[model samples]
Target: MSTLSERDSLFLEIAVGEKLISAQQAKLCKEFSGAVSENLVKNGLLSTEQVASLQQKVEDKLSSGNKVAVAQVEIYKEDTLDEKVVALAKERQLISEEDEKNCRKQLKKLYDLGYNPQLSSILYSAKCISQEDLMALYKEVEPNAKVSIVAKSMPFSELSLPTVPTIGTLKRKTRHEEVQQQESIPSETIHMLDKMEEVVSQISAPEIDIASEIAPLKQEEEVQEEVQEEVEEQPTNESVAPTPVATPMPTATTVTIPNFDKVLEYLENIDYKVTKLQQDQKTALTEALSHEEMEERFDSEDIPDELQRIIKRLRHVSEEEVQVAIRDGVGLENCYIPKMSSSTPIVVKKVNFTNCVIDQVDFAGVQFKNHVDLGNSRFLTKAIFKECHFVKDATFKSCEFLNGADFAKAKFDGKTTYNSSAFRRYVSFNRCGFGKKTVFTRCYFAKGVKFGEVEFTGPASFNDIFIDHRFYMEKCQFKDSSTFSGARFADIADFGRSKFEKETKFIGATFMKWGSFKNCKFSGSANFNTMNVVGDLAFDNSTFESVVNLRAISASRNISLQNIKVGNEAAFKFLDAHIGRLFVSLSSLKGHIDSHIQEDYHVARKEYGLLKNNFREINEYDKEDWAYLMEKRMERMEMKVKGPLSALKRFLNWLALDIACGYGTKPANIFVTSLAMLVFFAVFYFSSGTTEFVPSGELALDHSVKIEQSMSFIDAVQVSFRTFTNASIEGWVPYTDSWLNYVMMFESFFGFFVMTVLVVTFSRKVIR
Candidate 1:
């Protein structure tokens, strides 16, 4: 080897600086050059001036007997940098020969900067299958390099990453070095193995269409990463954890928080506050006032200028206080609530409001000054108006409540209407008191709606309210007639322990889900006519003081009436309600009766008696009272029939007397004429014998007895004509005993009757 002369070294350094070589490469190149720097310069590896100056040094170095290395001369070239990196990386045996070749091919396409940290680690770990694969990956991910938003604001607490001490890394390196030294082999042996590997890699390597295979893998991984990014971008409920916040205390505010105190003082100093006064004080004071009223009173102690200044200060303070209070968390109060007038009834005014968004406005204890209009406003935060009084008519049509709304303990003195308000979140009017007519027509309650302990003193109407969640009205009182016609409850509806003092109508209310009236009391007429229910309708332990009308309710499930009571007639005339209870006790006057007799009436009476005897041992009279009452009812009917029978007999007697009085002796005369006609026919039948009689004398006489056939009409006429004068023995045959019996009976019966009838008839005819 030969040493490099100063001039050669200087040229080499300059060339290295100008992309000709590297320092380590210069050392390696000069290690075997043997003073042949001039030859290297002549061969265009070094500068020309460097070669002419280094000829004598080359001779001196050859005379010194040193060897040199030469391949590092091109270390600064693009290809040389890559080759040296590949050779160094291979010397560590960190990757296989095939991987090294493939990686070189991939790294050739990269910018001359360096290898990727991940790709280099992978290659050094011998985990990379091919360099072309890694370069394709680098190209695909290069465009995707971005600052992760998730990691920007992450703190140690949020990151939850495992930590390691600095000493642990040094210890790990030491252990790694020990493992490497144990596996260390001879460099010449490694070189030989590398050569063998190079030959084997060359022989076994398959030509790859990088655009098809490696590029596609990179594209697939990129697509997968994009999908993962999209998934990460999606909003999740778990993304924001609930943090604790301090709650603010409640504050009270008065209406029109007195901002014009100064004006009021000015008016007072000018005697404007004193509009009227007594006659004596007005004449004595003699204060000049505008409008020439009969009298005026003024405090004439020379109105103090200091008082005016103080009033102005008070006015400023009051105004600022109001504004600050509102800024903190105050809502409109008296601006929404107005006083009622005694002469004219309050009527709801029509007003259109648009694009009104109120957030975090606490309306608790707030009132309106005039008839309010909230047409299309939005209350997106907690709204409360507890214990506030409204004196004028108010209308809230098409108002949407997107958050919790509280109107607890609120009182409306005038007509308050909610035509189409939508409560999309939790809404409550718990312990609210309404004094006048309140109407909620076509309102929708989408979440929990609570009216617990609410009291309505006037007529309330909920015409078409749709409650999609739990509707609780526990302990609420309705004094006037309340209507819930065409209303629907989609989920569990509860009116447990609610009181309705007047007529309550639920006409056409559809409870598509379960309805619970666990212990509700209806004092007046309760009409649920035309109600369509799909789920189990429970009215257990409910009381209806007046008529319970279910005129046309259709129920698909079992409508329970266990322990339900009605005071008056319980009408289920046109109901399609499924008969759920086989032992229902619904009476004509009181519906859903709870009498023991009804229970026994439904049960087999005998069976009930046996059960009672076996269990409670009820008295025999108690068991048999029902039977006795039934028998007594039957006996009472029988007694009534007997009395009517006696009256009917008396009526018949009176009718007979009336007939006798109308046709007095005419009936007797007709009777006598009929008797005479009967007697004559009888005598003719006996004397002119057409009748036959046979006597039983002796056997000999019977043989010679005359037998005659009954005569025909012509023969009978001839016989009767002959018998009028003399006896006709051939055609008319009669026995002597038969004639005597007929004539005697006719004479005896008809003689007196005929004579009396003749005398009466003669007397009546003579009198006429």
Candidate 2:
């Protein structure tokens, strides 16, 4: 048996202890699992011929095996349990869209275990699902080997067969004949009334069974005798309604008809008792009357509630009346509508105040229950809405404010649209609450817009808006999609410490100063494509439960991202971000931050230094050394200018340090490379046999053919090594000042370089 090397023995023992090899295989190697793997082909346990035969036997044994009831390749399909579970949960109202997303993420981890982990069981433990629902889901993911036999509870009598009525002596109407009679009515003539009549008649006089009724009465007579005995014991007066006497059957001569007016009157009265007639009457009155029809209906004196009366009276106030009321310094109740919820929502057809100039207006605490519109209106001096309430939709589209607008701490209960509106001075919506969707599409802010500490319970938008000064939106909460695409912030814009429940978008945005989004939480994806920033941008300490896309972004200054947490790091991709100075982790930012090291190394070097410190703190000495070495290499490359001497220095640095020893990251590479170089030179010298050795005058023979040709290949190789090593060749030597002698000298110096590189790399690896 061949003796095992010390390293081999150690590796084998570790492998065996870790169960990487089987105990049965150890028996063949004389009682050790790993020795068999290393020495099966090493130790002469069997003859070479027997080994070959045994290998053939093993292949035949494995290939001849079969598994019963195995599904075919074409039939065995992979089922995505996550998609199915998520869809089912949504359909059953068991989870919200956000919760469903979270569950699907959990399901992916379970799928990697080969068997579907009991997610339903986990939900059951959390009281999120019922046992019955869990059991139903369990059937889908149960192993194919576990068979369930479900026995139906119903008997044969419960499943009815198609009825085949027996032939009778009397003539009876067929269903097809009845249907034909009903279809014979003229298409233009409305049969809906006749249908109602038929329905009423059928309900009043249903089909009767004489035998069943007579038998029930006979049983009642017997029950009457028993009741009489009980009546003697205890008597009481309780009246029961008598059953209606059955109508006598008509003879062959009799016929029946009906009056249309009476029937119509009865049906109308029944309909009026319900709300159908009242609603229809109001709708018809609304459509038939002129502009005066609703005026008298909204009279303030007739309304019982004061709030509703005030709201109703506003319908009669014309544009001139409103202007007059404002000019006279009217209170909120006299000018705008009062909020009332007694009836349906009041909708004013039009609130046109276009081209009207408002000198000053303050609606600090007024409430409006109706829709408000001030389209194209101009606010010349001041407009204060510090705590105004809008319980319905409001629009200020195309309106302009010359002085300014203040909406701080305001509340919007419905959609608030500000499309194409212009504010010449500072506007504030700070600490405001938006209970529904709000839009600022194409709006212009000359000074700036502040929205810090605001909470948006619905979707919010700032599409195509222009801001001329600093914009602040720090510590905000967005419960739905929040978009700012195509918007421009002239100065610094901060959205720090914000929480987004749905997708947050900032696509095609431009920033003149810093656009910070630090310490944000995005439950959905954050998309920031095609953004251009002149100054610094930061997204430090942000968490993304979905992918955070930052593609096609440009920044003139530093673009920083550190401590980013993603739900699935492998699924993220950052493309086309031209970083001036990138701050990111190497392990997580592989291939994404690979370039721009030469362009922005001045500022990026500081982050690289920090990365080196981090790696050292983590006890990853190898990575720490690599980080430090790379930082130095970049610094060195930056030190030299782009010229002839610089180019020459770089070329020499690469050849001596990088290729030979991997910039001192690898020590063993030097020895392997040096051996390869020696072998290469030796082969070349032996094969060509061009150089002839000058002989000493010791009665030597002729040198017609090369002397190397007379020597064996090994002897030629020996001669080549001796020449490279500058060893004594005694009587044979290269001609003085010949190319061969020069080549020999170069090889000697090259060997010294190789040795030096080996020593430096080895020392670094050991010390680090």
Candidate 3:
């Protein structure tokens, strides 16, 4: 074994003194050459953090030159026997981690309240462990463990050293030794031993003189045997059995005790009945006192008769009453709490007020440390929960708020649910913070609800929420994904300037009035699919950093997307939407538009036409033209052809309308087409060998005697221009007898049609 360092010695002393590790474990750790802290952690005696904490304390003592005393270091107290048993049960997977934590918290709470409760009792009270399991665990930890029931009326001082039955020795072994010996004991024998110990431990009497007590019974047994032997020796020869003399009864002073097992059984039954009666009496006393307090408080208040009646029915009539009802399955009913304002906030745990009718109550600045349920309750007046901090799950399911409810600045650190609840008046949750998953599904808000500046650090759901008045969530932040799917807003719903840091969904939602999302930012995909709006819905001045799906949406009025920026990787989908009028700025049209519906030509065409008409209505002619062009392009690209002939025909149609005139939306295209045609004809006429041009004067002379000349490029251009305009080509004419005359005639007809198209396109553009 290595010699212990000063630090190691101090650590060992603290660990053993604090009972963090048994003395035997400490000795074993010291025998090893490794570091003390490392050995403690490796052997599962302490966690690394615990070792570090202890090491810090040791170092502080050394630096200050103060001697370490067990009494001075009271921060780490020893675990009680019940705590060890509960911990062993947890280690053996008999209880969950959450259950263990709850047990510890309850035990601490009881201790703080001046009640010295055992961990086993707390766990049993919480229904986390059963009586059988508790006894089994105790036996595993201490084979000779005894369970002694204490009356509820016993004081803490007396209860601490509960009288141990003198049936056996009460020596306790360290946990390490217990574990080493537990393997050899059969499980059945252990269970029987536990039962025997429990039965024997119930007798709280002092030690008895066993020899004196049994001496009378031993003498009576010997007398009965001697008399029986004498009768048997004389019975054979006599006609009648010798007159049986009754053995003299034991003296009255000599107590004849019953069988030992019978005595134990009788004592156990008496103990059980006494314990039960004590518990019932304690519960009755507590309730009676609580009720009297409530009645006195109620009588002192000069409230109305109707309110008094409601108050009388309430189980938890005051804040003080709430404390007494903290046990499991106890709920407040029809509570009527007055305005409470205190510098020190009240702390409550696991309060349930389900199905109650509560009047105006102010819980401002209160800190709730455990699960709170006010579900299915009716709040008769304005309920204020401002600045309240909920450290565990809070539920308000199916609750009705007749008056407005204010939760402004409240912070929820656990999952919160308000599903199916109704707020008949305006509710304000402004500046609140939700730290875990929050649900407001299937809720009704008669008046507007304000969630302005709230922060949702976890997934938030407002699915199927119905709002009869304006809903304002302005400037709020959703740090995780949020959903408002199937929500119906009968009035204006404004989420202006909010930030959705993850995916947001508004699928199948209805906005009966104006829906504004101006200046908002969607950092993830924004799904507005299958939405319906009766009035204008706008995303003006918003930015989408990812995909924006507006598929299958219907609006009876205008939908606007002005001055918004879409990221490069973002895609905009407006497929199959019933848009009455869209007011989108051209700058906002970034990323892929209608890329998903491109394969369906008809749907794509209809969508583009809607865009075109909307832009035209807004006087955005350039955007209108772009929409129109896309409409035609979709038709050309997605047109189905069954055969070569149909394919040829489709190609011709595209060439004529789209290539030449930009599908009648671009007059500039028409001009370009005409110029290209003129140039091509001029080149053809100049290059063809059979075609020749005659001068105007020569044409007037004899037809046969005219000298033929090849047309120069400039002369070909002049001839083509005049022929295309169908004007009098007085200075040039094709050879009269050659096949070029027919070609020239055909060119004249084509020129006339092209000129008509150009005129129509120009007139339309100018007029529009």
Candidate 4:
């Protein structure tokens, strides 16, 4: 370690230069140690936030045990650095038997000129070596090399490489050593040399393509050392061979960390960052911006003059290069050359940069005319995709959005898929438009996937979509409906105030941690069959225009149906469902009664009770009392209506009461039925010729009394009215010996019972 005095001198000078400390403060701090001096100077000029940030960085460094970390790389268990170096050099055609002498000399020159001896190591640190590529490289070297991990290796900068001798330069010194070395060399070394030559003579050679993760513009001031200490240098002696290493399995690889603060600053200040253009292009851009009175949407008409110029020059961009294009705070834009020839396909290659740390990448207003595949990619920093238009199919499978991702107002005209992905932080898809089918299958959202006001024009699939933490989809509009089959939620799965226009499906879905669907509107058939919810399923103030099939749901918790408006086609078909409790309103219960969907009696019993009580609380006693009677009626209806005897008895009771007055619940039915019966009986009496009636105070006891006076319709009605009222009147007397006498007797008894029932029912209705 550097001496305290030397450190103090260095730190004090730095503090003074950065204006973080006054000259006098620096002078006073110069007497202390480096760390103490830094603290004192920081306290003198810096705010608490700045001091805390610096302290955090210091703490991280101290905990890491590396004063100046070069690679920020860790050692792997299976593969050693020597093996990787050999593989990379051989694949790059830098080290081979035919050109071994030249390769060594070139390496020596590069090392002497202060260049990193391992450019491949640099790429590895940048997370460029994929698992597939690494395994392939390992297999090729495993046969010839007895690979082993070196124990307690030195730092990368201090490593000593094994020097390879020149075969082309056959000098006196080399020839003498070669003759003696060949005799003393181990058989394994000879075997390895022979295999190396054989590998070169093979039919096909493996290719080594090295590219860093998110090799963006070098617009910052960070010069990182590329040597990786995880890999040890190989043995230099040709006589030694069969060196075995006891290595375990490989685990997570290393990644090169760029200067994060500089990258962040660059991204935040990247206003109007555009591609480099000539004078003519600049003029076209200026003219295009000038023609726009307001910020227009995605059409060529907004920038017609610019677009026409671009039409002449623009070709299809089939390949996107990943390299640093920034220097000295100015973006040296990468040439987006179009590969639009007949020989080249118009589709661009994958925009994949796994484990790459890229800052806010503004892909706004970019139009993908062809397919774009970005699978297994990661954006470690923030990203922006506002107003981006995908004219064709686009895929982003197994990608991660680590930082915030903004995809607001983006348009997808074709199929867009994001399968088995993860979003660690907040993400937005607000106000986005989907012209074709879109999918987000089995994706995990650690934070809320805020997708408010989005319009899905085509079918959207969120099958097995998991909200690992929180979920939000307020006011979203599924214009063509969607499917969320097998979706699992953990915490706060809120989809409040959304709209579904067509068929919505949630087949086999599990809303476990917390479920909410408040104030939503479903204008079509919604299938929630087989959905399992361990939490409350809130649908307060929801509206269903058509059917909502919750047939086989297993909501073990309560479900709220407060103020919900279900259409004529829908009812809670909780046949096999297991709901703990329910919250509903009177109007909603009335709807369920009208719909009369099949449900378990035990499950429905509690809900009916609740409905009745709620109605009473709201001063709707008529409905409450009716529901009470209806509840009992429903129970009776469920009482095994299978056999003929039970059916006959139920039919008799229904005829006696429910058909006419709904079991004393409907007074209108009683009045209408009684009035009709009275008229029919009166007409029957008027048309009959079996009996004659005499207008007297007494009745004739014999059938010999003929019709002295013809009985008219008015006289028959008056007699029928008197019999219905049960009034004693100076009226006609019936012939007791005639068949009409018995009929009149039965009618009088029935009329008395009917009048009594009507009076009691009317009194009950009025009192209640």
TM-score of each: 0.35, 0.38, 0.56, 0.44
Candidate 4 lDDT over 294-397, as tens digits, reads: 12221334234543343333221232333211111112121222211111222233332332223235566666565655566555445677777777777777
User: Candidate 1, TM-score vs. the true structure?
Assistant: 0.35
Model 4, poorest ten-residue lDDT window? 246-255
| lDDT by residue (tens digit), candidate 3, 487-582 | 999998999999999999999999998999999999999999999999999898898888888889999888888788878766677777788888
Give each model's whole-structure lDDT.
0.47, 0.54, 0.67, 0.55
Please give the lDDT score at residue 526 for candidate 3: 94
Best-performing candidate as measured by lDDT: 3
Writing each residue's lDDT as its tens digit, candidate 1 over 1-768 gives 576664455445444534555666666667665544544555567676655544554344333311111001111123333343445555655456877554444333221221122224224223342334433333333323221111111111100111111110112222112222443423332223222221222222222222221111122233335434543654453222111111110111001111122223333453444334222223212332221121111112322344323222321112333334333333232221111111112222322233344433454555554455556555555566566667666666677776668888877777888878888888888887877898888999988799889888999999899999888888889999899999998888888899999999889998888777778888887788888778777778888666666555776665665687766433323223332221223242222322222332332233223322322222333223333333232333223235878767645433332222212334454554444454455445544443443322212122245544444445444433334323334544335444444543544464445445556645754554
**What is the descending lDDT order?**
3, 4, 2, 1
By TM-score, who's the top model here? 3
lDDT of 2 by residue, 588-624 (tens): 5442232332255543444445456656755667767
